[model samples]
Target: MSDRSYRFTHAITRKPAASIIAGLRAVDTGTPDLALMQAHHAAYIAALRATGATVIELDALDAYPDSVFVEDTALCLPSGAVTMRPGAPSRLGEAAEMAPHLEALYADVKRISGPDSFIEAGDILMTETEILVGRSARTNAAGIAELAALVAPWGETVREVHTPPGVLHFKTDCSLLDAETILATRRLSATGCFTGYRLIDVAEGEEAAANTIRFNDVVLMPAGFPRTRDALLAAGYDLREIGNSECAKLDGGMSCLSLRFTSKP
Candidate 1:
């Protein structure tokens, strides 16, 4: 296994369902156009492949409206994957649907089974040394404790961070740019969730810009946030921009679309 937690060699994604319009929407971005969403998804997948991680494409479940946001289903760590129990009732089935895929990829797959535990991978950020868990409406303290216990054997630690008010997920406001850096909105940074890492603030009014995913060598970010794009590039990182106009309408973005990981020996 590699030493870095974010160096992924594989990725998993599911297509958006026709019922995606029924998916959770915290903001009024309008209904997503399915055809346009697919095109964006294609571009997102292309970017993931460009990172040199083999993409494991899964079929869309017409039953789960938010299945396309696969990252909510599990946490991919260096030791193994922890199949999650999503806090959103509508999204609960997603973890079970994604478990087999994770089991096929990792040797030691663990699961969060507490009847009251509920967490989503999007709310959990795996930094180089610790797991920064966002305590939000979508993730309960029980879930965080369960997750911490599940990965304790791997020498991975978990720390709880307060999510900023009015965000759907913690990742909706911040993301790990590299081992020692975080791309965050000023609002989130003000909360003091990130203490030791260098904060690269996104352009004012581009708070969503901090949600990009750092793949192997290239970070995949949403297009149209030009000022934020410039900021990311100026910080000395390679990038691949993908248009997520449709997905954005339903509270989705680059990191929401895929579950990236590396297999164990």
Candidate 2:
């Protein structure tokens, strides 16, 4: 019921630029079709609005190829917003670009500023009482240290979780389904990072489905994963499937598409 939970009231998303065709991809899934990705991005913003959030859609940043993934720029906490120090050099400018919008909605905005610190919000998982951070190649110790300090005053605890190899982010392997439930892959589940939560396992061969995002009452999942769809339906969730084939090429998922927050803009 709190802002730290899935009951979001506001969201921030950016339109994907035509330059998104050149977004960084780990395995060379080939360039995404610009027109198709834009259509998908539109539908994603619509989905966020349907969740009852006042969605703020920013103009596309043509200069930044990966600017559409706005969630990586900051962590929206109930108290304020914390700008992230992106691990990817190409994405470093995104934090500054997202500042004006965040400041307009939030009165307080903190940052992780260190010469050696690098953290992407994609590596941090938020819950009602605690935050699980991934010590991935993109997120370093200094970044985690900074986050722990900012959230401590709000009565939130930060715990570090070991990320599996070959993943771009911690959320690439799992996502929170609800307040007490988590949807995760077998690989990440074995890490024992979610020992206290009720975990719902994704269907075999549907590991990518683990990245679904629960906004308010519905879960926005990636389309084309039938087995995983059945798993979520069986779990009693009202689900909405979004096309993500194009975004997946750039290592993005449902959670990376927008920054969901409860504060009114």
Candidate 3:
């Protein structure tokens, strides 16, 4: 088996700060309280670092408010980092903004082009043998095919999983906690998605728990999901609860806030 531990790279936003989607959409929306958002981001970073993994913080983007979610526009893989084509038009600039930073961190970088295809980082998950990609409104068949070709030589098979239309992102509804197990809400199974994989059910009130992040044997979950957290603890996993109040406002869960990478040695 391959031996590698997960690492994290995160960016803190300053302007047009993280806010609730409903608040952002409001006609007279006010600025998001930055102090609270920063505190939450700091706590999350600390928790990940506690796992004995590397933690790199991207310098704050003073100009772009939405740049905090660096994971949505690019994915870090064993081969290199892949710049994505965000499905949301409002988020298109994110890819371009992430290119320079990724280029500095990685020796090689690949991209998914526009007009013909699109792919989002959150729609992609990496396993030891293959890369599982989700085909959703944001990610197309052409994009998945191109990504597959890029990683094929590395002996990685790109499995395309279909996503239901209304879900915001694939990872939002279903998160690959590890190579063998996945945490998903009932909504995902109702659509007959993710064939061949074992699904761990998250209760109705604990649906948000499906968004937990797993690094090694430690799972970082959001606060207030005691039942789900307890279940995970009972399963012999260490659980850490962090407050994600600002992220929840934008329909983001623990998984969306950051992209994790496991380095194979």
Count the clashes in each prediction: 0, 0, 1
Residue-wise lDDT of candidate 3 within 1-265, one digit each (tens)?
A: 3523233333222222433332322123344556777888888888877777666676665554566676778877766777888777777877888788667766878887747778886777665556777888778898888778776765567888876666666776766666666778888767666566667777777776777777666788888877777777776667889987666665567766665664434
lDDT tens digits, residues 143-227, model 2? Answer: 9988899878877789989789888899998999888899999999998999989999888898888898889888999998899
Q: Using Cα atoms with residue i matched to residue i, what is each candidate's TM-score against the true structure?
A: 0.97, 0.97, 0.84
| Segments of candidate 1 deviating more than 4 angstroms | 1-3
Top-down TM-score ranking: 2, 1, 3
Candidate 1 structure lDDT: 0.88
lDDT of 3 at 52: 76
Error of 1 at 239 (Å): 1.3
**TM accuracy, model 2:** 0.97
The weakest ten consecutive residues by lDDT in model 1 span 1-10
Cα lDDT of model 1 by residue, 17-72, tens digit:
99998888888878888999999999989888877789988998999999999999
